[model samples]
Target chain A: MLPTQLSALLADPAPGVPEALDLVSSFDQGLVDGLARVSPSAFGGLVDAFAGSPLRDRVAEAADKIAAGSISDEHLFVLAGARSALFGAVHDALLGQADAALGRTRASWPGGSGDAATAANLLAGSRSWLRELAITGWRGVDHDLVTAAGQTIEAALAEPRLRRLATLLDGLAAELRACSPIATMDRLPVRRWGDLWSRAMLLAQDGGRLTPSEPVTGRLLVLGADVHEHATAVQIQVHGILETPGTAPRLVRTSVAAPKVDTIVGPAVWRLFAAHPVLLGALAERLTLDVTDLPLLDSGDLLWSDARAKAGPPADPFATARVLLAGAAAPAVPPLERHPARISEPVFVEGYTAVDGAFTLGDRTIAVDTTRLPSCGPLTPQLVAASHACIGLLRWDDGGWSLQPIAVLTMVKRQPVGVHTTDWALGPTDPKVVKAAAAAGDAVAVLRERAGRLLRK
Target chain B: MDVERRSVAPIIPPVKPRKLAKVPFVELADGRLQGVVSSGSDVERVYVSSIGAGSHGLSCSTNNNRPCGGLRGSYPCKHLQALLDEAVLQYGADRVARYLRIDVEEGRSLTAGLRAHHEPSPAATVFSSFLRHLAYLELPDTTAPVPELHWFPSVGAAH
Candidate 1:
């Protein structure tokens, strides 16, 4: 019930503010006259403006299966996820009228207002051309929104309102040349590694049980590992969270594996948990565990085989990530219902701050993405400018929304460190992880003595 | 909300490779110059070239589009001169000679300001963006926030 030029660009004196570059050239001529009234011969007037809409019977059953050319690839991924949820509800109602007209032109324009920085760079090139027209009408169904709408159309063609809307930036440079993976790898949605191991064995036989199963103590923490390798196996994974005194923190992971040696390249998950000393003493006694019977896999994976451990009481993983980012929420599932190749979404943040490489917090910011930690290690921009709780995987690279941290929590000399107990992911038996693994020379003790002579031949 | 701690830097600054194993990926991006080279007689091949700014339009193929028989004629191959020598060692020679509108002079060298031509172009979206940047090192470390990584770009056009 909006679209009267986006309800006069979301009302309240925003019908083109203090002539903000004539309201950013009438929002680049109303998004190139709303992409020539949603062409394809005005798509039956946008499916009769979605009649009696709840996306009008899935936009009239995806316009009668694209007028009967017999659709299917699961109705072309439900008609490109219902035309990207109807152009993401008009790109989230023009990002609430371009973040309230760039927060009222940065709180009442004035000083050095080159027309309020060219009307806030033409309202950020009309919000990267309405977010690349709602991610090119969503074909290429989310590979992290086609890599953040091709880095928001390469930072919206470095806008100085690049000649207003040159054919809507040449159809966002031909939808960033049909976002390659050989052009949307046959429009995704095939997903089969035996349907992700039969949806992880039907999410581990229906909701991997736990309710009052007795033996459920906690305090695990850890949160970092990730190694990978593959073509035959090297895996690693690890990750953590547990914290069960008065419940609510869960997300776990485990993995490990090994074998794939083709000349041991990039090893490090603390040199394969230092050549598996019984999986590094069951991950150093499940990082100070007070656990029993772990198994639980309703996707928060964790099964450390017939687990049962003791040593607890000493948890300060940044005060359990400030009681799990003050009781998290706002996730109610949906990352393609949790994980069909889950393209990044784990968070945690805590008292942000950091600065330049970015983090900030209250007034938002974020940025940090050290290329989503390629085989972890360097989180440095001087250790995220001396942290105070980070824990990573926010995603979308280069053109913004960063945070690939992994584990942080700071303090050091005044004690409380925890980048999984320093020397990045523990082990070398402390004395400050054997003086930071002998000043980074004992390359994980020569790759754990060549992976313990190739796992004892 | 005093938040300042300063440090900024990143309007562009993100090229840094210098060699990157014979053009493992170059950039300039979309307006073109592009990347993903590799193949000198296949160490498991790669190609995905590009050029295009100011109709210098060329391409080289292989991430399945095939082509690249040393992309003949209007010169420039040897994997597009090793992706213009690793995009002049990750964007330098006067910003890849002003993003391929090549002018070069002072201590000239962005391939001595050449003019390439062959106009082919698709190499599966710059080798599907170098295999989605090598599938972000096979993911799974976890903490989870990928709601399309909060569709970034437009912090009021950054600076």
Candidate 2:
């Protein structure tokens, strides 16, 4: 149970993270029991204490609405919203502290010294944890848990071994005055794969600009293609990186829409393309073209038009592509601007092991988000194990960073081989595609046959 | 390029299935082990059950507030047991045990440590969550863009 002193602190007009933490930590089983039995209206002042918070108003309105009635769905949602807002405020404050500490440590140690690097890595880890807490709205957290987290950060800030890193410990005393919460009520609505794809399509529609018709030529390396099965259409989006010498590589994509058909089964990538000869040829030309001035959208979408094409020197583009990808730096995006299925930045990640459905890069393990992938045909453990690197989008979704691999690179008999992970959806003629399809078994043929018989009737 | 030339070693082994649907929704939130459980007899019926973690104050009632007959007993009802089992499945056994503040040595079961008595908690909140979960299935498979997703970083020049 909260001591009288701590309980008194809860009445403060604006409580800082420290005060909030203390109040939450003081909640024992008996205190929590008491809280559950009481009406939400009894704690209306607590809600009002977060002055100017939109959630506070909403919660107040909800409490009043339910004052003379039984609890309803709105009450539950409002309660969750209130909890999220309160917890989010605290997490955001902690993140600000961590960010400030990082800035100080970096400033003091300009040189890439060992201590500086270790401190930076530790701070980065701490930031990641705090960011995740903010994303999850600190759900299921209790007082003891919050205290342990606070103490750990406190100790890290005061550690004598890293004196330079510890300089920001005094800043921790600064009161977090703002209680504004990023409204999370919208997140309560469960979203599915279709919803995400629709969102991507919507974003793709607006604010796109066409490049000058004067034509800029570059070597286009077709990385891969993803086939999306929607209700009305089978949409195939092909991805590639355009390299103009002395310019930064630009990620580009093109889409092909085909009528929905039920006869094609078992890995639509191979079956669909195999049946569509003309579409297959166009895809082949895109892959074979050495240089082309394709009309392009600023969003990296390629537009079909009177584009020039030429065959240049026969050399592997994968090596140069890897070198370009290594130097690519993604622009920093704030947390609020991130979401699931949003491809904020496209880059290549090399030197990682795929294990346990995640990629281990150095000391950090990022889960492989298959949902964002256009298609999962070539992402089998066998292919992943053989690959040395992958090119994909860096996305912040489900409360953390995930990579959606579009292409995979491997060494076969000492030759660097790059295959579009989505190309398995292309023509089954490709030996790699044939091999993958074979491994998937005769189920494909059986399904195709069944589908064919059904169509014939 | 043919990847078959090289010997393919399996990287990710098949995952062990931890099906958590014995009880549809269980969460450690609001200082309680609470969720809505499907009725054993009626497919359409559900009971909202919650046990305050350390207080062991139990509540089992239908969405409309009718108390369960099982609440008369000192021990948790079958629905609560199912909730605990699913909670262990959702969050690991250790986390569930720790949240409930129950003492259990290594390899001992969590339910063995639980104790409960009747103390009715409002069932509306958990029932609402279950309804929301069901609502996801009713949503149409749509190709049209969703307005709610606009907050995501724009992939175009607008950003």
Best-performing candidate as measured by lDDT: 2
Q: Candidate 2 chain A — worst ten consecutive residues by lDDT sum?
A: A171-180
Deviation from native of the Cα of residue A15 in model 2, angstroms = 20
For residue A162, give model 2's deviation from the true position in Å: 58
Per-residue lDDT tens digits for candidate 1, residues A185-205, read: 322211111122122222211
DockQ of each: 0.02, 0.03
Error of 1 at B18 (Å): 7.7
Docking class of 2: incorrect
Tell me how many clashing residue pairs each candidate has. Answer: 8, 1
Candidate 2 positional error at A321, Å: 3.2
Interface RMSD values, listed in order for every candidate: 21.0, 18.9
For each candidate, what TM-score against the reference? 0.28, 0.38
Model 2: residues with Cα > 4 Å off, grouped in runs: A1-215, A245-247, A262-293, A305-317, A328-340, A370-377, A410-419, A429-457, B1-159
Candidate 1 has a DockQ of 0.02
lDDT of 2 by residue, A1-457 (tens): 0122112222232337545433222221112222224454554554565557767677676556544444444453454344434434554443333223222111111122111224444444344333222223322223433333343344443433322122121111110000001122112112221122122222222211122222457776565555443211244565555677686765555554432222123344344334344334444433434446665543345553323554444333355355554443222212221223334344456777778667776555666645433332434445555677776654443224455565678888998776554444444445764675565454334333322322232
Clashing pairs in 2: A269-A425
